[model samples]
Target: GKNALLLACMRGDLVEVQRLLQSDKADELFFVDSSSQNTVFHFACKEGHTEVVKELLRDNRCSPASAGLFRVTPFSIACEAGHVDTVKVLMDDNRVSVDC
Candidate 1:
């Protein structure tokens, strides 16, 4: 169930992501994929899904700076993946520290 959110983010499916976010299982926004320890936000950033990342960040509970395995934050993942727009989005968030 939560994996669906991660998958949606990975595929850059903004509509599906929005649908999932509005569902009762909104907590899935914070759910980290067990194998990767990456949250939906991380998946979105890594996939260069700027819209998906923006949608995820709209939720207050979605931590902009939450690190997954290897202490890799979404911002770092975005940069590593060459997601300039996603990086810009994350940089705009006050909770995301560039120093991290």
Candidate 2:
């Protein structure tokens, strides 16, 4: 329930991010911030943290998302940010709407 970790993620601080998620109890990774209306997954995708994305997906609790579900999804955010790798990662989830 700490926003600092998610903020670090939004800022793309991989080192701090990992430190915060050292335990990575799935709940930590799945924490969604109402302020940003984003999960850590959304931040990783928006910031193009492809490796983080993969790590997140490895967790069964990491929910599949299409556009932030509030405004933009990870895939849509990645595409908008022009991160091809991140977009590709999102594309791997057939349930996500690439057209969005």
Candidate 3:
């Protein structure tokens, strides 16, 4: 159930995502959506949706963030997509590795 909701977020279905979020069934904003092969943050970063990314960060209910990072984290995706702002946000978190 949670995974499905996050998947909708990955596809940028903000409307459906908002609906799912409103349901309160998916309180975790950081849930990973494997369909895009990334976390919700990854999708927001890759798509250059700064507002969405900011919103997710503010939620505080997001996942602790993957440690393995699998090289698929928002920071990596942002770097790959050439979105500097996204990269900056993730990089700001010292816990997230960017040397790779």
Would you list the C-alpha lDDT of every candidate in the order shown?
0.85, 0.70, 0.62
Please state the error at residue 42 of candidate 2 in Å.
0.6
Candidate 2 steric clashes: 4
- Candidate 1 residue lDDT tens string, 72-94: 88999989899898899888999
Point out where model 2 deviates above 4 Å: 1-8, 11-29, 66-69
Per-residue accuracy of model 3 over 42-78 as CA lDDT, tens digit each:
6667786655665566555553255324546666667
Q: In model 1, what is the error at residue 62, expressed in angstroms? A: 0.7
- Candidate 1: stretches off by over 4 Å: none
lDDT (10s digit) by residue, model 2, range 1-100: 5566667766777666666666555355567676777777788887888877766666566665734556777777788889898788778876577674
The best candidate by lDDT is 1
TM-score of each: 0.91, 0.72, 0.62
Better of 1 and 3 by TM-score: 1
Superposition error at 83 for model 1 (Å): 0.8
Weakest 10 consecutive residues of candidate 3 by summed lDDT? 62-71
Candidate order by TM-score, highest to lowest?
1, 2, 3
Question: What lDDT score is found at residue 34 in candidate 2?
Answer: 67
